[model samples]
Target: MSTAAKQKAKAAGIRLDDDSMDTPSEPLAPRTAPGQLIGLQGRVHSQQAEIEKLKRALEQRAPGKLPLEKLHEIPGRRRRLTSAEYAELKANLTAYPLAQPITVRERPDGEYDIVAGHNRAAVYRELGRTEIDGIVLDIDDSMVEYAAFFSNLLSPTLSDFEKFWGFKSLQESTGITKEELAKAAGISDSHVGRIMKFDLLPSESKDLLATCPERLGSNAAEQMAKAVAEGREDKVKAAIERLVSDNTFTQAQAVAATKADRAPRDRHEPMVIRRGARKVCQISARNGVVGVSFSGSAADEADQWAEKIRVFIEAELGKQ
Candidate 1:
């Protein structure tokens, strides 16, 4: 067996010896190392042919003007321009009139499938424009999804909520894993996980975030999620209420306070010293050490009490 194969077997917790290689558990195919090179050459040529075909298609069909009614939106589009942005874009387009052409793919049903520029198209339609300039490309079904994903993902106006949902929608639409989505979305794997943490919030919390997404950020959302996970939903709700009412209230402080509330107490309870049914101080002791804690007027008189305790100890020792 080759060194690579041996390493693989070792990784699988299988021991392979020289004799084991001679008589394998399963019949192995004859090594076709040279044939693999030929197969690779054939694959290269096939890929080159495919690329050439696509190039020819692009060269033959240039961009043209298409009616707005003929264009159709993809199933999942993440970019949603705000009303103000839409109005601004419409005004700009009306002034400039066709600064850039939107991209679309000609479908078999005679309707053009918009790959990018859904927002631009909507703006044009809102302006009562009949036809808009578009670059019609011949793209495969797989590339269309990628086209939509990259198009909306690169938008400057994309919100964090939109981005979170974009990753989710693309993963569901394309059946891709989080790791794959992370790479395509140009973010770290944990970033994807963190964005997904928003979903853990209750509907009331989610609605609160939806109103002012910029109010509570991902870190706050994570803390809130942690609070929920620890069965501190009531505390989290109170924190949210405080957050909504008080602008000075911080999420970090809320998370810290919640965690402190849940912290395990010391095994032994402190003894309370009282005066006339009124609490004065608490004395805590462990092992060989005795601690006296004083409060109010008792604190001012602690020195005298200490001297008396020392004398008492001395007298007890003398008697013993």
Candidate 2:
């Protein structure tokens, strides 16, 4: 046996040359059942269906389950549709005939669930269109998520006042939390809270409050509410006018006022006592509360009074 012959024999798994080797063994295919094949195919089909659903969601413009029909009236909505809005919708429909299809989900009863397009749907109803262009959505347990409220905070095509008040209506009806509402509306919790407090404002104040929640915090509105409740509607109106006329008495002022039921300040929280231009006493008091004690007239006098209070407080603490 030469080297070549030996190599050939080793490769053959037998002590023989390649030229003398027998046919090689090949791998065999395992038999598969028709039922098993069908099941596997079904799994693949199911996966494809899931992918399509994801794609649809990615392509969707609105959030939540399937959208509602345009023809159906929005249900349980606290905000009434304004005449101006109705007219605007009518005008848009007359001009464009609803180029965008409204989103809707089929209900058990022939009607459909509306997800978005409240305005368009309203227009369609007023137009007497029995059926309109729509995108049917099948919302299985999963809901589409939304970004911020600014997306939904578009002007109502009615009035700016309606926008804020309408937001409150929508939030209450939809059970959306104040924090969530703030996030959606692209505002602070304080801002949302203030806007929601507009109901406490006078008819004259609503416009100003809506335009300036920073100046009309919950507490301040409550103050106005308290005053109005206390048979001081005139005073409340005066306070609101002051707010509108000047950016003073906003936020903390409003909040403080609203919280108390016409309770006089100096009862709770720190209270500030005016000492005129003389050397003063007491502490810094804002939003109806003051701190410390002593007397002062000017800023320098106030500082001296503050120092005296501080010295006395330190002396008392030292004794303790």
Candidate 3:
């Protein structure tokens, strides 16, 4: 195997012997080296021992009813469900028994950190149930995060925004690169990059997304991020706000809103007071400011003209 492949296998807790062939073309010959045969036997024994140990650990932590009060929720471990979805889940649980037990890891503080099925536990609590069906996982703190991430990532109902946040949390916790994350998640590098654009959104927009992750998708988020980078942050925020508030608002329309043009302001044409062919004075108004320029000999009459304009304005105001 290549060095990179070996490294990846090692990370996943798989031992890759350098001399081992992944796909042997023919069966081992009777004249094969005795040392190689002995090595293979030793490896098989070691693997069997490990498997037995794992089975024992699993038996010790077998699924059972756990106290609801002792179960603790870990942030970023569970994906948020929409209100209607939560209601639906609760109704299903109420009508039938839990199909799958929740996965949890026992903490030193006598509490269990939820590894998966947060919504299930919550619904059980709301139904006034004292305990829930759960199984304890025999994983360390580092593996706990990986377990939670994979469980949530594989969920069909998980939104792209939620997936992005979960991937981000994993990256921050493990200091893993994007390529490594994509490999770990079994997704493409470009897909990871597109989902990560949600990070480029403004803080307020992110806050809104936290409440409704399904409101916007990764593709729309990419366009909005581009708009924000081009100094259209306020418009992007407005688009997200509208998207969250209005049920009929589409993601494409939200993206278009960032590029929407504002209403044009009223423009005034410049006025020039001239004497036949000789230009006397020119006046212009722009952005609430008025400017006047005198031409040639008209420059000498600037003060008189200013006094006359001030008197005319004062007389107009007095009439009002």
Candidate 4:
């Protein structure tokens, strides 16, 4: 150890062995390169200043009022509040003014973007107020999805469709697949997949589910989506019509009934056409289309029998 270091250590109550240090060496002084020492001192001062700034920030109050005109709404993966929900919020706020501050981030355009408390800001606007209390945060643009999601997590009135759309928006905006988002959002992967299927549904079916989101749970929606995927377009539309017409049936029952009604019927043997001991032809009908096939011998006589076949069909229609 240098002589000055030894002295300093000794002054600081550090013990050293004198006999081991008996070898002659240049005396060690508390020497540091001038520039390096200045740099280190500057670093220490900078760190202490940062610590003080953090302490002051922690002690600061919530941000003051932000003008409604200067606030820009956040887009992507956020649920729109229902009219009833809006009314309820307005009523509550009317009874009692806002106690909690909303959250926002300053934009480069000199406007603030809302991070949370959309409904509150909306209510304030409805009340003819020009400004509302909020806190400014340093949220990254990439984190907006999670931030919007968690902000609405505690809401009790959000519908299944709304949540689905929110998750979908997150998936699209963040470039994450539904499976990855499912884990992050604390939803089942299968459920996420099912919700995403809503986008694939025909517009008519989508509107039905959107209008009555509470009626159709994820399972029923998935079932309907599966039916759509299987090319049961007419059946899905019919099912949606039935659901709209009859409010008595639950979504599950409606889905079940639709599935049962659309199930492929068992193949029935074609009706045999016989004249006495001779089998003439076979008749079959599927999806309202009728077909008649002639035996090898009768095939040559099909043209001759066409007039008779028309007459027979007319007779059958008359009977019906």
Candidate 5:
């Protein structure tokens, strides 16, 4: 294989070394019959042939312009941009030339599959453009999905919910564990765990997030997941719905809404009544009762003030 092919394969986590291409000499199972052994060998040979085909296709090629109609969208390969973001992209493309060419790979059917830049291509089409500058990668079909994933993963605007689904899709595609994914993605395992909390969300919440992924973040998702585990799924779902509908609602407030009981009221400081730096009394309210404690000379006159207060209340009641 060429050095370029080796590099691409390595980036996709595929080993293209001679050792990996060699067929197994020993039977996969000692109890396997001759026919089964032949079948296994045939499968290995087929895989080797496919790898060689991919390597040959990886020969250097310059980027060229391709028609927009020829570029096709592959499901699960591209992240959907929000409507506002799409409009901004369209406006930018209209005012300025494309800064970067999209990447695509040619198919046997004489069409191209988009490996990245789905939004740019879409914007160009919306602008009534006929062709777009594209670099055709000669990678295998299996590697196309991974290419698209990594491309979208690096986007700064990708939301936490979108990232969670991306990680999930990559995991299901590669069958790798969370730890392995963390290492591969160059992120902490704990971060991966936190992102995966989206999986614990109810179907209704997931549906809402699919529409507005930026509504909730990883931290809020973790809190909601804990609430779900504690049998508060309904509250969590309601909170997420409110969050989606109300743009002003924050992730922290959404998590708070999932609590079974209302948050405790803030404590109020006592109000001190003083006479020229002398503490006369302190008035405070706690648990629905008001208390007044007199100090110094005020203690002796407390009964007099109490009688005045009683008389004032009686006069006010008589007016009412």
Candidate 6:
């Protein structure tokens, strides 16, 4: 395997000597030859430190033209903008130019390597503006993944949908995997998995999240992904409405929604199901939708007991 692949293997715990790829035994990260990690680790750490220094400098550099000849396409990067979206952003760039300069590392040949802000760089290309603003650094393309992470955080990046796709793209472009980014973002592996697993989502649905990543999130988008995957467009819309109405449809909630059935009165009525003073289910409403959460063992038996109670109540009501 290549060096980058080896590094990713190490990060992902994919052992190189796995005699059986089909074996279910836990795998190990791919190994490098002896003494390789020492230098590789240091370079990675140093590259990170260098980017930290550039963070402050990045704020002060005014946007301008990038010398076209010196500019290079970002390695492992591509444009995710739709044609219409690209046009709109290009127009904005034409009017105001870049508010911030794209960060790059100097090439051995005296050119520059783009670190962050490919979208803006692409706009510069579209407008035919040469010699744009940049902060030349010393790191190589191997460590450019750091720039992508910081860019995601440093600015009003993608809409939730866009961020999801962008995050996936960055992962693919760079060798950084979802597991690594998820660890950085303080989410679970499954959480990251759900975020990137948007295969069946309609283009419209994907575009919605891409346009509004802030309103949606990794977890929230996952719910929509599941709903679409399950062919429950109507349920997806209702769940989103309920989610928004109750104001509890966070990204985590979105993921959870995809995994289970929803209640009917989670939003409008009191959702208390108790047996012998043990409260089994508790409902919290958001965005006009009610959410019912179960607790303790009573939750395990709630459905059966609820039916019994309903029958008893009907009998009592019939007597009245």
lDDT per prediction?
0.65, 0.50, 0.77, 0.64, 0.75, 0.58
Lowest summed lDDT window (length 10), candidate 6:
10-19
TM-score of each: 0.46, 0.34, 0.54, 0.47, 0.62, 0.43
On lDDT, the leading prediction is: 3
lDDT of 4 by residue, 1-320 (tens): 43223222323341111123566894553366986566545644443343233324323646688999888776532345657777988898889867666667789998988877788887898899998888776644534444554455446666666567566554443345566667655668887787776666567666665555555566677788788777776777777767766778677776775563557775876799988888889898877777888887899998878878899989999998
- RMSD to the native, candidate 5? 9.9
Stretches of model 4 off by over 4 angstroms after superposition? 1-69, 73-79, 96-101, 128-135, 139-146, 172-179, 188-194, 197-200, 207-216, 229-231, 238-257, 262-320
Query: Candidate 4's C-alpha lDDT?
Result: 0.64
lDDT of 3 at 129: 98
- Candidate 3 residue-pair clash tally: 0
Estimate the TM-score for candidate 3: 0.54
Return the clash pairs for model 5, or none. none
**Tens-digit lDDT track of model 6 for 46-130:** 4334545454455555555558668777644433555666787788889995766677767778877777767788788778776
Question: Going through the candidates in order, what is the number of backbone clashes in each?
Answer: 0, 35, 0, 0, 0, 31
TM for candidate 6 is 0.43
Better structure of 2 and 3 per lDDT: 3
Native-to-model Cα distance after best TM-score fit, residue 109 in candidate 6, in Å: 0.8
In Å, residue 226's CA in model 4 sits off its true spot by: 3.6
Candidate 3 lDDT: 0.77
How would you order the candidates by lDDT, starting with the best? 3, 5, 1, 4, 6, 2
Q: Model 6 residue 214 lDDT? A: 49
User: Candidate 5's residue-wise lDDT over 168-247, tens digit each?
Assistant: 75554444579877865668999999999998999778878877888889999999999999999999989999999998
